[model samples]
Target: MPTPTPWYARIPPPLIMLFAIVVFVAVMTYVLPAGHYERIEVAGRMRVVPGSYGTVDSTPIGILQLFRAFPEGYKVATPIIFICLASALMFAILKATRTIENAVGRLLYKLGTKRAELILVLLTFFYGLLGIMVGYENNIAMIPIGAVVVLALGGDLVLAAGVSAGGMTVAFGLSPINPYTVGIGHEIAELPLFSGAGLRSVLCFGALAITAAFNVRYFRKIRRAPETAIGRGLDERGLALAKPLDEYAVSGRDWLLLALFGDGLAWVLYGVFNLGWFINDISAVFLVVFVVMAACSGLSLSQISAAGMKGIAEMAPATFIIGMAATVKVLLEQGQIQDTISYGLAQALQGLPTYLSAVGMSIGQSGLNLLIPSGSGQALATLPVMIPLGEALGLSRQVSILAFQVGDGVTNLFNPSLGGLVAMLSLCRVPFDRWLRFVLPLTGIILVWAWLGLLVAVAIGYS
Candidate 1:
């Protein structure tokens, strides 16, 4: 018999997908007509005029320049790349000091035997908040801690996955302050950063509520009938490896580190909301926190340097992935087919009713997300086009941004290409298929809610 290919092996890596997109766009510059839109400064930001798209002389990128796009993409992606690396390094230093493990161990001990459900609720909300503030990808390191807590509470790996990955997925979809999606999307749409936050906050909380309720119901069922859990068939040794709640104790030093970390997070929030800091500014804050935390934890200078390097090395793949994602935009722009694609989409939606048009935009954004999984990458690639299309259809730019946000985030739960999701699931020993099965229904429900949210935005003329 012929050998079967493993499922994981079948799914192409992000790098491969990016290379394919670059080549595809390079070919497209030869086949598709080159075009552009007229741009004008509006209130200190660039805005593409709604009716300015026009076909222009084709600007085909040679094979040489096709390779050049890689370096150019890396340059464009440097801010996000450094931010991810710096954040990972800070977390690595904290891990080297055993601060996070000891603190989570202490939390598990304090929750005791009867309050498992409370643990679930608390962790879900906590991680969701992290998703809103930092990002979903940045929280992959925390999933193992959540798994240990879930096991200590007699819950299964799926519950652990839910509290960490699932919770963050929901929050990422809805968070008003998520810089990667909402911030970038707004900037691309030429709207005020974090504008329409009041409605987004309400929607985010609603998502949290729905996720919490679902997790609680499932946790109770599994506790009653362990065999019904997704991880039921796994051997005892496998479960033991994932459950490490008894591994460490929280000392006075751990408490101090926790306090300092909390304060650092507060500083980050202040910088972002009050000072209008972007990724570069936030990376600097994390760098400062890394130095202070390393000193307070009593690490020698050499040890801190080593740990920081190790952390950066671990996250090097993620940095590469961000850079590769940027190449998609580079290829489209260089080919001059970006505006051509956008103009076609706008013309196709010309006669649709307002509500249906909003829904179509949401659906289209969702489809695009499968190919371009990075929220900021997708925003940079699509929002310029989408905003103009929305205006051409008489929809608010806010509505266009909302569609992009929900589309980019909601689909992340099931997309196999999301590196962070895959890594977290692997860490927890939860199979991808099981996660798909568990999350599919919730995804459907969320999509319905998102459509309704868009309808409301249209009805109220949200902007």
Candidate 2:
């Protein structure tokens, strides 16, 4: 047999991004004229200006000036790094206490032997709910469990990989509670905090159902008929069944119970009783609660601190990716590339029909999503351009919001700019190819679903 490929040979997302950035800068600087764009105010004076974008000098002078003039921009790295460290430390402590393994085992056992289809569907739905409640950044640790489930059932690894990544992609893209992208989009569109929740939730659920069905069909094919005559091993499948708690002395049930109750109570109070404190900033709250749980679970101050540090260490690469992406944003702003792209798209497509502009604005925002990476950042950058265009086209603010919601959420399924996506990859040990295999088809399905949903929303007088 040929030698197995080394892990690092896989797609190097950061390096590829660097190349793209260089090419973008080269095209924007050398070929494009300085006066290619005109200053334009967007969304009732949102401070957006076009022309002279991506102007950072490729020379040493420009490089030196960047660090000297805008030291504050680099500070954006702090929060990402801090949060990651805290998460790593927390998970490590949980691992040491055996709570993480125990919790997963209990979950698998409770799931029990039943209709495999139902289990898969329920698991997919759980992923969507987790996205809404926990945020995608924190839920990636569950992928190994997903893999174990697939293998345990004698399911195909490819099918298992698809379901695991696909479910996450849908949840993340349609995140109900994520303030980063969806929240920013709503703000730019001037919609309420919970605006588009009805439609967004429905889309998330619909995507989950569609993905579960696809995985189930694939699983059946693998189960009923074996394509290869070679022996199919079951080592990976047995992980969930193995007694992981035996390795660690303590399971920390009380601590886990508290964590679950705390999480549940927070969600209930926020969603049902209108407790603003819990929902207003859930991520911060989650961090606090998990930290407390670590301490209360019989961990010493040193252990808790160490666990937090480890969590942050795990997040370092993700933090770097986010920081680099942000740097590109700064470059875009300086070079006036963002506005130029926005205005150019608007001006070039100005002659298109009215509804086309509405749809195009959404599509345009999605295109920006690839570059901006952060949903919130993209919304802040692009929504100013799109919302007004929507208004000029006689589309309602709601339509504008819906378009953004769909566009912003859908593309993160595979975008490397997303820290959560990287976290998911690390947790699952799923390669980009494996992730894409499962996600591409589901992405197409959701893309069509979003368009149809937009049409339906318009027909129902949302606009």
Candidate 3:
């Protein structure tokens, strides 16, 4: 018999967590004094002044303001939610036509059992490369597809998220061409653009390879022991889609759908690479695919409409979860306590030795991610102080950026406040505690990886 879910875990974790965090942040607005730092425009973005912290008029979230956070969070989360709904609709159409089942069936048939482990590894590497190529936030839309793929493969959503978001987290955080943290870090440090690429490239690839292996191992474990699945009362819809090897048959229609999927992705990638497309733009492209695939599968207009709505309905709760996470950031910003917290965290690193200071900078960056989820925002807000501090402690500018890159990326893997991470988990129906249970050890391993990398950089006087 399946273990009964605890009373506390019965309510969806995001709703409970959102309520708790919303109230907690609201209370904090009153408890923590409101303050901010001076900002000066540089290259079209405002950069924070390191020592210009000053008290501001307190704007605590009273009862009225506290209640307003949800709508505001929805507002902040709307664009990503839209993208998610659109992608879900597309996948729903595929599911309605059994396109996904056939594709996975063909894959399992072709790969056989021995080579099946490579699926998770390849997907992790592919998504990690997407993280490096396009940018991280934009890839949140792809999480659903990854979920469906893994679900059809009979793996749970925890592994789904581990493959999709985990790949992005490791590679995007350490990407040499990140253009957000590393890019802005270089700008603030007045270094050449994308300088010190060798070390970061090595770290990114090494981390990606390690993450791929981790996810593959997890997949194999659950395949062997179904009782070990992390998602409680796990949805079994996907597991039923896979047919036995003897029943495998890949038809012409399945081949057509496969080509269409590849074609849609290629178009989206082109837009991301050359057209500067973001979430809304990607959704438009997917909506087009949603239409094309429906027409190709001989889905009637009524059938298309029904499948599309079903998909959106299936994803509706996930949209709210994304908003709830976004709400945490919105409330923090509204409280005007963001800078205060940033300044406070930065202040703690003042007297640490060079190596520990490097580690501290990463830790501060990780903690600060909860407050300022954006990579560029974090680099702008914290690098001014961290850079000089690292230099004063005899570490180089590149090393400072490395710490920011790793720290900024690490917390993102598990931070509930991050909409992208939360969006992925909610889409997969994996609770936050479950994610922590699965990822904490990996997070620790990566954290130590960053610390050791920083130690080596400082020891060799890496520039």
Candidate 4:
């Protein structure tokens, strides 16, 4: 009999997939006609005029340019890359101080095993809230701590992933302030940034509620019958690491560190919402918080630098993946084929009813997300085309952005191209197949909810 390849060996790494995408897009530059839309300034923002797409001189990216796309993409992706690196470093320093572990351990001790379900609900909601304010890629750094907490509380790896990374992915899709998705999405659509926040915030909470309920149900199932648990096959090392709740007391210094973190988070929210902060501002907030926390924890400058560097090193692959994903956009733009694809999609949508067109836009964006997983990158690549398409189909730009919110955000839960989610699952030691089994149904439900949300937006002439 022929030997079977291990699942891990069979799946190519994310970078390889991204490289393949680069080659594919380079080929597309030759096969697809080059085109562009006429842009006009609208209240200081540039937007594509509907019905202005025209074939342009072919600007096919040569093989050499395709090779150079990595550096070019890195330049475009630098802001997001730095933000992720800084957030990872901040959390790394927190881990080095053992503050997070101590805090979570003490909390688990007080809550006890019987009330463990509440921990699931609370942690899920907390992570979801972070998703709304901090952005999802930034939240990946916290997943291991969440996994440890859930595991120690007698929950399995899947539950840990659910409450942390899983919950965050759900909330991120529904969030009004994700910056990467909603922020850039609104900007590209030329709507005010976070303009429909009231509706989005309500939807965010609803999605979180659904995620919490789903996680809690699975947690109970596993607790009642460990034999049937999804994580029953987890290695001995992982099982042993889930320590029993110890009597670790929170000291004055711990409280101070916690306060710093809380205040830093509040400042970030204020800066983003009130002051209109972008990626660079958010990264600076994390850097400042890390430094202040490190000083309060009595770590010397050398130790803080070491911890921060280690955090960046740990996240290096994910950071690289971000740059690589951006290459897809780079290649498409260089080839001048993005607008061509957008025009084709728009023309196809013209024949559909207005409500169906809204739904179709959401569906199309979801499909696009499979290939381009970075929310900001996808937003930059697709929203310009989708915005005009929405107008042509009698749908408002707000409705189009809403479609983007659901499509780009929700699909991340299952998209293999999403390096952050893949890294989180790896951190929790959960298999991709197992995660699919656990999340597929919830994704379906969320998609239905999203479709309904779009229909409502269209019905009310949402703008």
Which candidate number has the best TM-score? Answer: 3
> TM-score of each candidate?
0.78, 0.73, 0.91, 0.83
Ranking according to TM-score, highest score first: 3, 4, 1, 2
RMSD of 1: 4.8
Clashes of 2: 16
True-structure RMSD, every candidate: 4.8, 6.0, 3.0, 3.8
Q: Per-residue lDDT for 1-463 in model 2, tens only?
A: 9999855356466536643663464356444433223334554434343223343333221555444423343455445544444445445555545564555555555665456778877777777776666555555445555665665555655555556766777776776656766666566566787676777677777877787887787776666777731123422422333554233332456456446535744554465336444222444544665666775678788877766675566556665555554555555555545555666666655666656665676677677676676666566565666667666767777777777777778877767656556555544445455556556676788878887777776667573
TM-score between model 4 and native: 0.83
Pairs of residues at least 3 apart in sequence or in different chains that clash in candidate 3 = none
lDDT of 1: 0.74
Cα-based lDDT at residue 176, candidate 2: 60
Alpha-carbon local distance difference test for all models: 0.74, 0.59, 0.80, 0.78
lDDT value for model 4? 0.78
Better of 2 and 3 by lDDT: 3
Better of 2 and 4 by lDDT: 4
- Would you list the rank order by lDDT, best first? 3, 4, 1, 2
Q: Is candidate 1 or candidate 3 better by lDDT?
A: 3
The list of candidate 3 runs beyond 4 A from truth reads 1-12, 140-154, 231-233
